[model samples]
Target: MSIVDTSQKQRGRGVLEGAFQVLDALSRFPDGAGLSQLSRACELPKATTFRLLEQLVELGAVQRHGTEYSVGHLMARLGENWQPHPRLRRASRGPIRTLARLSTAAIAVTILDGDRVRVVGATRGTPGELPHVMADSASVSRTAAGQVLLASQPRRERPEAYTATEWRRLRSRLRQDDAVVVEYEDVLPGVCCVAAPAPLPDGQGVASVSALIIGSTVPSALPGLVLRAAGEISRGLAVH
Candidate 1:
């Protein structure tokens, strides 16, 4: 399709068609595609293609190198989570609820969405109250769930979430295995969160299983529960 679908405007599609065209073209080249290449591939003017790419980059759906753009962290996660295979949301539902009940804490299954963590599955900590809403996304350098997923990534693949010094400090605290358990008490002032990694076959954490408890001190058993729950989910994903 041509890059900008002018007819889409009349149909009230907004700018989505232009954005999709850019992403569709970028997905064809694993190493990335230059501005001119993408423009030609999408059959759009260079300036129009550049504007679309800029917006996609801002949304974390596309990454820009020196002159080329490619599928970004968020898009890559979506591909795994929403396309051609079952995702953590399905495999983690039962395990997360069980953990929530056992720990009396909120449980969430999260994956990296750009520099932030995107919660895909959540079980309430209590009967009626919602856990702290993550809104668009949570900081990768701060939250327990975010940190676990960040730690799962290779040291060389630094997303813009953390600076060099910050990454260095955080990286030291990372566990070497996918079955990691980490606790953070100050993420939400009076709250504490503990997270564990659910590893994929590639040895990277496909998602994090986390428990949010309302207290300064985390329950000693909660960490073990989180780890086991994450492991259960990981095992399920492996065979699928």
Candidate 2:
């Protein structure tokens, strides 16, 4: 090809790659993502992501609302399937609910998405408590769920994977235990939570199962219950 044609082709390839990255990043956030978040998740320059997002918005491949972006009507109609998060949610829903009922505390399933923890599944306990401890899309360094997911990752990846200050605090406070880590009223006052890493068939940690109780002290039996529930959810994810 001629030099100009070759240059154009290279630029076209780059655009295509960038577009795919943006889509993949957006897919991670079911609720939607802002431009800066999308750019950071996709590791692209804000300007480049902005231009491509604008094009995608125009093409109906992506929808933009005031400041957030999500898969558009056209994209949804195109029927792209094989979303792991949704599948994980479905698999863990029953176990999570069971945990919540058994412990009389809210239970949440979270996975690391980029530098944050995404709560894919959650259930409030029978006593009627809100899940302030397991908020949707919380930073990994600030919550027990985030800490579990972070601990599951390789050691070298931990330092840079989350917010530096929060990571440091989590590292210091979270004991090196494979079972469960209990935090009392750290994320929110009057709310205590215990978290365990859900292990997959391959022995890799897939998610964190947390039991959030509305109390001043961590329940004695909550840690074990959360651990077993986490294992059940892990097995569910493994086979699926």
lDDT per residue as tens, model 1, 24-110:
998778899999999999998999899989989999999999998999989988776452123666788789889988989988887
Over the stretch 102-197, how does candidate 2's per-residue lDDT look in tens digits? 788877877765554556777742211233333234433446776677755656345444577766656564445456778778668888878888
Each model's C-alpha lDDT?
0.73, 0.74
The C-alpha stretches of model 1 lying farther than 4 A from their native spots are 1-19, 22-85, 124-139, 156-173, 178-181
Q: Where in model 2 is the C-alpha error above 4 Å?
A: 1-15, 18-58, 62-84, 124-142, 157-178
Highest lDDT: give the candidate number. Answer: 2
Candidate 1 pairs with clashing backbones: none
